[model samples]
Target: MDIQHVCILGAGTLGTRIAFQSALSGFQVKVYDIHEKSFELSKKMIEKIAKSLVSSQIYTAEDIQLALNRLSYTLNDQEAVNQADIISESVTEDIEIKRKVWTRMGEIAPEKTIFTTNTSYLLPSSLASFTGRPEKFCAFHFHDVFYSRVVDIMPHPGTNMELIPILQDFGRRLNQVPVYVRKENHGYIFNAMLLSFLGAAGKLLVNQVATIEDIDLSWKVNFHVPMGPFAILDQIGLDTAWHVTHQLPDANSQAFAALLKTYIDTGKLGEKTGEGFYKYTSK
Candidate 1:
């Protein structure tokens, strides 16, 4: 089905970028969050970012303004779902959180309204079961700063293939590279590789194997990686990195568990908390 009203549930980094880009693709967007302050901050951030896109000629002035106009921010739950023809849930990485969202969306929205989750780990099957509507449910996973380019569309075995072409068209309309995954898998494609690096980096910082700046510059000089792992960890918030690592059951589980528990217990939650692996004084 052709989606018009695109509702994004979450005011986080990925959610905000998705809403901004969706609106730019000509869909009326409603961005919702439970936290009032977070929602407001994200709204203003998007406004500034939209203007930047226009200045960069990545989007026209009219396109950017129209996109901004299409976006509405709210804390109301049922109202946001009611207004959406397509729901993109970017809330948290927790499966339980997404399950609740999916179940709630199904109860609030009409059957035809599409359901998509931005989760990188959780599979579409289990997530769709929350709504009893796995068929119309799918995963449209976006890379960080979602508006830049790459996105992956994951549909379970039960996903409605009738709309696959339309979904691809929608991704193209938003100027994204959309790849479809027919089977359910955790971490999809991008995050599978990303989480590996995330753990490795955190280990370094925690062990004092290298200072943050030394780690960052090493990447820039040697691998020419876009950003160093420590810098990224700070930007992503140590708590978030900790959570992802803690959730995974892998070879790194022991180290991740130790690192994460320390952060959580000590309240060193990265940039948002003014300290994590690094100290911050920003208020």
Candidate 2:
């Protein structure tokens, strides 16, 4: 199906990026969030990304303006999904919350609206039945749309096979390299590998094997990559990292989760809040 109107169910970091890119790709985009502050942050984040895109010559000023014009924000559930051809959900990573959101969307969204979750580690199958349209639901996970640029199209067992190509085309339109996950797998592909890498860094810190700086330096210096694991954690908000980490039934994960909670308790939720393991001048 042609995806013309895109509805993003949350105005968090990833949702904001997806909505902006959809608008950039000439889709009418609406970002929905219960929190008014989320809209403010989402708009600010989009503007920041737009500035970077323009300065880097990746997007012309006119292009950015047109994209901005195409994008909108809303809090009304019915209005958000009424005209949406596709709904990309990036709500809180909690299962109960996701189930509730999908249930509500299933009740309100048009029958033609394709349901997708931008969940980093959750399986689509787990939430498919909740949507009341298993065949129409799938996982369309994106990672740092402009930078990472890989979108994972993972369909649950009940998902219509026809959706793969449609989502693949849509991913390309949003300037993402589409990767298909043949089966349901938690964390998909890249994130499965990433979890291990990040977990190792966390273990080292928890065990006092090395300082966060030394551990990160080891990875960066060895791989000659720009950001280390801790620095990467900063990019992925500490709260998000904690949420995923805390769910793992492992001692190391639990320990890391505890460490992350300390940062979260202080409201230092990584780059968005200007402090995590590292400090950033820009939000």
Candidate 3:
């Protein structure tokens, strides 16, 4: 299918980035969120990313302006998907919430519209049936659309094999490296390794083996990389990390989830909230 209109079903950090990049790729994009405030936040985040792209000379000022012109925000469900050739959902990481959203989308979206979820840890099979069109649904997970540009195309058992090439083409159009997940897996490829690395850092902190700074320093120094696990967690958002961690039925995961809960309770979700494992200055 030739995709021209893209619908993003969230206005959070990742959703905003996906929508921005889709627009930059010359698609007419609409971003939908329940909360009106999320639109303002998404816009600010897009502006910040646009500035970086400009500074890096990845895109010109006029290019950014034209991309912004193609992007839009809305609250109405029907309006969001009315003309969408494909929908990329990045809603909250909760199962129930996602099921409800998919069910509604199945009802309102055009019959020709393709469904894709940007869920971090959830399997496409778990949510595919809820869409009322399992063959048309798949997981097209993206990690940091610009910097980390790999997009995972994972299909459930019932998904049509034809979608692979279509989605692969779409991912490339959005300037991403498309990776095919042969089977249903929790964290796909990179995230599976990432979860283990981050879990180790959390274990050290919960066990009092080292300070967050020290643990992060250990990884950075050893790997000769800039950001460590804790710093990376902050970028991923503490709430999101907790959501995935708390679901694991392991003692170490439970301990790490509890640590994350304290930060969340105080409304310090991460860099988006200006704090997490470390404080960040607002751009």
TM-score of 1: 0.88
Quantify all predictions' global Cα lDDT against the true fold.
0.77, 0.94, 0.96
Candidate 2, residues 1-283, lDDT tens digits: the string is: 8789999999988899999999999999988999999999888889899999999999999999999999989889998999999999999888899999999999999999999999999899999999899999999999999999999999999999999999999999999999999989989999999999999999999999999999989999999999999999999899889889999999999999999999999999998888999988863
Please provide, for model 3 over 1-283, each residue's C-alpha lDDT reduced to its tens digit, 9 standing for 90 to 100: 9999999999999999999999999999999999999999899899999999999999999999999999999999999999999999999899999999999999999999999999999999999999899999999999999999999999999999999999999999999999999999999999999999999899999999999999999999999999999999999999999989999999999999999999999999998888999998863
Which 10-residue window of candidate 3 scores lowest in summed lDDT? 274-283
Q: Model 2: runs farther than 4 Å from truth?
A: none
Best by lDDT: 3
Pairs of colliding residues, candidate 3: none
Off by over 4 Å in 3: none
Pick the TM-score winner.
3
By TM-score, highest first, what's the ranking? 3, 2, 1
* TM-score of candidate 3 on Cα atoms, chains taken together: 0.99
Clashes of 1: 0
For every candidate in turn, the CA RMSD to the true structure comes to 2.7, 1.0, 0.7
Rate residue 232 of model 3 by lDDT: 95
Cα-lDDT of candidate 3: 0.96
Worst 10 residues of 2 by lDDT: 274-283
